[model samples]
Target: MKYSLVASLILQGSLVLGTRDLQPVHFKAPSALHFRDIVRNDTYDFGCRPIAHPTEDGQFTLHALLTESQIAHLTEEYEDTDLSIHRPSEKRAAAATAPIGSGDRFSGGTIAPIGLGTKASGSTISSILNVKEISSAVQGLVSTYGVTTLNLPYKTFNGATQFAAYVGAGTDKSQYHLYLSAGVHARERGGPDNLIYWISDLLAASKAGSGLTYGKKTYTNAQVKSVLAAGIVFFPLVNPDGVTYDQSSGSLWRKNRNTKSGSSGDSIGVDINRNFDFLWNFKKYFDPSEAPASTSPSSETFYGTAAASEPETKNHVSIYDSFPKIRWFMDIHSAAGDILYSWGDDDDQTTSTTMNFLNSAYDGKRGPVGDSAYKEYIPSVDLTNIKTAATAAVNAMKAVGGRSYITQQAVGLYPTSGASDDYSFSRFWAKSGVNKVYGYTMEFGYSTNFYPTLTEFNQNILDTNAGFMDWALAAISVGLT
Candidate 1:
């Protein structure tokens, strides 16, 4: 009944607040163009008079009421890029030479097809997996390969469950782990689906007695053996209810399904990304007046009632506690084409050498040179690796799909509080002083919000797979000088 009410309201474009009073209330956006996470200053007249607040990047975060026709118009704009259109594959490699002092150029062999349900060209929603399907696929991998499925105890507002897969749990528990998560914002469907494709490729490589290869670098069977021993953990979908809702209603819902105390009015759900406990609403990077995240429940970036208020937020905390061996973490999102490192609140973090390295590397440069700068790393983070592994990953992604993903500090892009990557890094580095786990956030794609068509979606998955693999390698190779 709760689900039906929301869905019905979305279809009707109006909600009743009192007897004989119909309000033109804009609820969660019904399409990608209206995604609440987007920072836009332009206000098209939607009924109920949309409200706007200033955000960074010279844009405004909006909460608006739109009529049914307005939503249709917005959706038509989003569909401008057809999903069914096939995109030609990019050239297999970059120019076959090196530029002196410009940095190491990645040369690589042709990409091998390790099928995880993407076509050589074009994209299709049919290839993507739902929550139940994801669970089944994970179980299949567990049975066929040595992967282990770990279930989280949390359920979404619609009673949907969440789970994860562990690739090396049977090995020594002391081995470090690489943690990757996607689908934190339900409408960003690519991240979760991309993880499945990546996991499938890794499992396939493991089964075939071959190592995974990204660009020119191939992890030989020996390196593969060692990396597998180190462990890989993946959370494919963090907000199942929200994903289900988006796919069903064609709405770009960015938060969890938590609603206002049994009321079906206005917007519901907290932005899970802003609900983490660390530095939550920290005045420097986040104040309700200045940040996209809000104290009100109706906001797309709504911070929950209190820090770590939602089950999803608590579940991530449990994950952090469960894995003391976690050496690298990435919270993947889409449509930005960026590989972001932590200290998300600011570009210059007092404690981060990595932050300093990145700010200098790509501060003013734009386009390819700036995009390649993610490889810059400070030696103090790890004596064994003065070279950052992120550059190789970024380059590999470019080489595969020609998507230029810039690497930088998280705050280099925008101010965020209670970000998962920041919290993950803070858990080990700031609070525990371990400083072993290096955290990251990979914002994939070069398009608008999370509503890419199948063609764009498949390309994004292909483009990002290389970077994901590189990050996994870096996680396992930490502290090796």
Candidate 2:
């Protein structure tokens, strides 16, 4: 009876998901442009922002989280067109999602979270870390490995004190050149785990004067030390409030819990990834036709009240100011299985230096790929360095004997505004005398599968740890100073 009611309301195009499950659906279109039309609508949730992946049949596949009503609406709308939508059997999908860790796995900051790099083959993580365990895991490292944790300025909407950890560079903040962050989108499980465990491996291996291995991939003591010397500063659990809600309710939540906009389910949060200060005022910065980020509070890609409006977004931006010399930055996300690099606002062009994001002269002409209008300008040399680092990360991930990975320009399937990678890279051009930081977004695991099975969870740690290994080494090769 409830489902029938939902279906009826969906036909009227007025019903929203209220404690209902979000079905995972895939839409295949003859060309990628068909997705551009879908992206403009504010009702859908594209995992960590949509990027259309090419299928073997010469079509594009976009993975989305939608209600049964939304899927039914799209099914009816595209029935006569070349576009098609599909969902797997509910029973099969129901059992495959991995479980979230029920108790504090870190035992309230006493036990360090060990990664797959140190475990035997086929070993699995019991579950994804609970929200409190994310903090506990990092604190365990402080006592065990001499890690320093610094508190950020802003408290979350829930009044949570956010903190970041930096090691190997000592007390001088400017000495750190590599920065990493995870859990920006709360439901991307294992993102914080991947970073924390990798840091554990680096510190442990350095202390023992040993090597680290992730399945078939291996890193020597020298490689580990080189990456450590680059000085990594990590901000894990950017949206603890949202994560706690998602873990407790199993709602697949993807934003920070801020109620200033709307105070109910599906309308209670802002996407931290989309709330960054780069091209954040999408209506003014991007092409008028493009919905690079949504304006609606209920939308998954909502840009929020203003640029860097949410405390999570502000805390992330403040990291760069605290560490002025950070030469490389990475924001970890999941389920896309690719490593993405900068200029996500539009197609990247290496020729015209003046046609960049800061110029108000090209304000209304910035998006739309393959057009004669303005494309985001990137220096050819900078482009090469980003591409090199991106390729190295994905290559090492593929070499882990688990899955194949690829590198892509961040703006591949659809353009995005205010994304972390673009904001990191834009700082070099937007600010005066700041270090030029090449930004990257690493999307790991299966397509749209944020909650991995136990096997995939273990595999994700292996794949990402190796990827981080090569990513840091490649950055060092490109020169940190």
Candidate 3:
């Protein structure tokens, strides 16, 4: 069968959020762990201030400008931390302290453009395509190639719908699945764009009757055909309402548009990243100083009333469970230059191929635990083939644009419970069998500003394309193994 008609036959199942208890969980935002301490906090670095409390709108408006000293402090903290895997060369680092000004495209300046499509990459492409443009592009691919495009069965509080594009090489039902999803937090605009660009490149190559190339290696027709035999699913924008609000209103919305009543503010959303069921709101998953879920509904990282309560979270879980064979799952996020693996809730002392290779590449021999609560645990599967694929993905990314993304377990970045990446991996890996899915959160861009200006955003997209491509290719290879 031709590829274009393939996905249309796949079921666009109803949005079935299975029956679950809806008891409201009082998530009190820890007073000690203010907004300043959150790993994903970009308020100071970007032109924004933290609200004293959550508002009717779940996000803070991007209006507060930071002082020179505050900007410097945040920049220093970001640079000095281990989470920052690669730094700009010495020449760029020297200019890090300059007074914030309208930044030039090439110079490592602080000021970034506020809008998208202000700059063009080629005659056909520009920086930062909006949600509409992105969705349209995906549809175009599906129309031309007969690939599957699944509309998420649920709409946001504002009635915004989302979709996922599936690209596969064959019609085999039991083919291994490789999942790539982005835009979980609405403010992180770059995640979906990266996947879109990667998909476009892959589809273009497939159509031209040519093979895809990575670094010095080129996959011939037979290789491409064989590798693509597996299924690749890309959920580009999971939080459409949040992205729309952030782009259109310049608000820093970070959660799905869920208009439920909360404990403190009238804010009506839940942080989708923290709404997953795995380790959901388990106080032990976070440090006393860093309670992962906020008690206040208005706070940024608020996990919802119940695990998987939000429709978006339910959609993600439904997709994962529905897939027959998943060898790799990547929940792409932004503004951090890290490739994080599972066990985000505790210190990772597991002995598996994935852990060994990830720690070796990014952490040397000894994998550093993210917190003191973690004790050594064993993995259910031997991760040799999976580790090989991961090493290739990381190396390929670095080879492209000379931009290196640090690889570590998710907890290495910060202690957070109910994150999607951890949940995705744990579902398979935590099982006592060898049928494991290598799950990850591939964070793009090194800056705190999830929403960068058109020029910078485009540049980051271009620079990271190599890595994304390599990761996709590796995903195909691992599926075959």
The global C-alpha lDDT for each of the candidates, from Candidate 1 onward, is 0.56, 0.86, 0.55
Q: Which wins on TM-score, candidate 1 or candidate 2?
A: 2
Encode model 3's per-residue lDDT on 407-461: one tens digit a residue: 6556553356678876776665444543456777766764445556554465556
Clashes of 1: 3
Answer with 1 or 2, whichever has the higher lDDT. Answer: 2
Whole-structure CA lDDT of model 3: 0.55
The Cα error of candidate 2 at residue 376, in Å, is 0.3
Instruction: Report the C-alpha lDDT of model 1 over 1-481, residue by residue, as the tens digit.
Output: 6998878776545323221121122223223224323232112222111223233344433333344555565556546542111111233112121111111111121122233322233333334555555555566666666576767877766777677777754754345477788888876667776787677667676667776554333456565566566677788888777776656554455678788522343356777888887556544333232342456665556678787888888877666566667777788886566676655554342334554322434342211112332222334444223127666567667777454666666654335567787677666435654435666777786432355655566667777777777666665555421
Report RMSD for candidate 1: 12.7
The TM-scores, one per candidate, come to 0.68, 0.94, 0.68
Candidate 1 lDDT score at position 258:
86
lDDT digits (tens) for residues 400-479 of candidate 2? 98999888889885778888989999988888998899999999988778888888888899999999999999999998
RMSD (CA, Å), each prediction: 12.7, 4.8, 13.7
Q: Which pairs of residues have clashing backbones in candidate 1?
A: 26-65, 108-216, 384-481
- Model 3 regions more than 4 Å off: 1-124, 171-173, 211-227, 262-266, 284-289, 351-373, 376-387, 429-435, 476-481
TM-score attained by model 1: 0.68
What lDDT is reached at residue 201 by model 1?
68
